[model samples]
Target: MTLNRSIGILALICLPAAGIWFWQNPTVRQAPQLSFKTIKGERIDLADLKGKLVLVTFWATDCPGCIEEIPHLVELHRQYSNAGLTIIAVAMYYDPPNRVMAMAKAKQLPYAVALDPSGSLAQGFGNVQLTPTTFLIDRTGRIVLQNTGAFELQDIRQRLNQL
Candidate 1:
């Protein structure tokens, strides 16, 4: 093959890999605003949380993955909260409001926990349909990471540390 043809072939191969990387881990340029009355009755607003690293986590009470991820999230909250991280844990629509309330209380979740009873919260977040889907919004209010399924805590921590 000519040198030019080899370069073209390499470009073609790399293009698809780049596209897949962008597709699977897309950045949410401007995260839709979210305001919710947390299970604890305090109102939290995404817009109001500017200048802080925000983790908008969507989880359901019944999801085993969600259950397993809480402790790690709590530790993240503990490690980073005072340093500028804020996590808003939202219970997914399928989980009953009462159950969400019960679980939040039972867990004694250190961070704010909100119930998506009307499904509005999840809908605002691109119609979030999966449990343990998390978005990491940068300090300037732009969402930089969208994670679906159980959080890869080590990966997440690395990203968090970079911010």
Candidate 2:
């Protein structure tokens, strides 16, 4: 009777923990729905890039880490762009569109960029608290990789090679 009771208690305890684990895991969550305006004032749907690897990077113009990461991202885009990779830089901070555009132009970024004025997309993607947070989505729209800090060029290349 004691063994049965202990097993029952264990089952009760483990069930909720497993439920929480599954809830918080990105693999279990639905692919975030993203729709925002590009720097050119055109609307873009995240789903539109199906069948290609998508690199969605959340950044702010004033963030030091973000500033440092842009050049690496640009280089990554340049290197892998012909290999079916699409890099999208999403400016999440509340900055003027012209300011963001000017910065992009100054940096000579070759990838596409969009402004998240409402910040809804960031919130939907799990509140993305840090600047330079990057998400690597596979061809099927699954978030295969998520990095919360700056990434090295070789690291990105290695990850892309797996996809």
Q: Which candidate achieves the best TM-score against the true structure?
A: 1
Q: Find the candidate with the highest lDDT and give its number.
A: 1
Estimate the overall C-alpha local distance difference test score of candidate 2.
0.83
In model 1, the runs with Cα more than 4 Å from the true position are: 1-24
Each candidate's lDDT (Cα)?
A: 0.89, 0.83
- Candidate 1: tens digits of C-alpha lDDT, residues 1-163: 6999999999999999999988966875888887978887899889999899999899988889999999999999999999889888998777888998888888889998888888998899888898889999998899889988888889889998998
Tens-digit per-residue lDDT, 1-163, candidate 2:
9999999999999999999876644453345868867887777677887788889899988889899998898888988899999888999858677888999999988988898888887897888778889888888888877778887778779889988
Q: Each model's TM-score, in the order given?
A: 0.85, 0.79
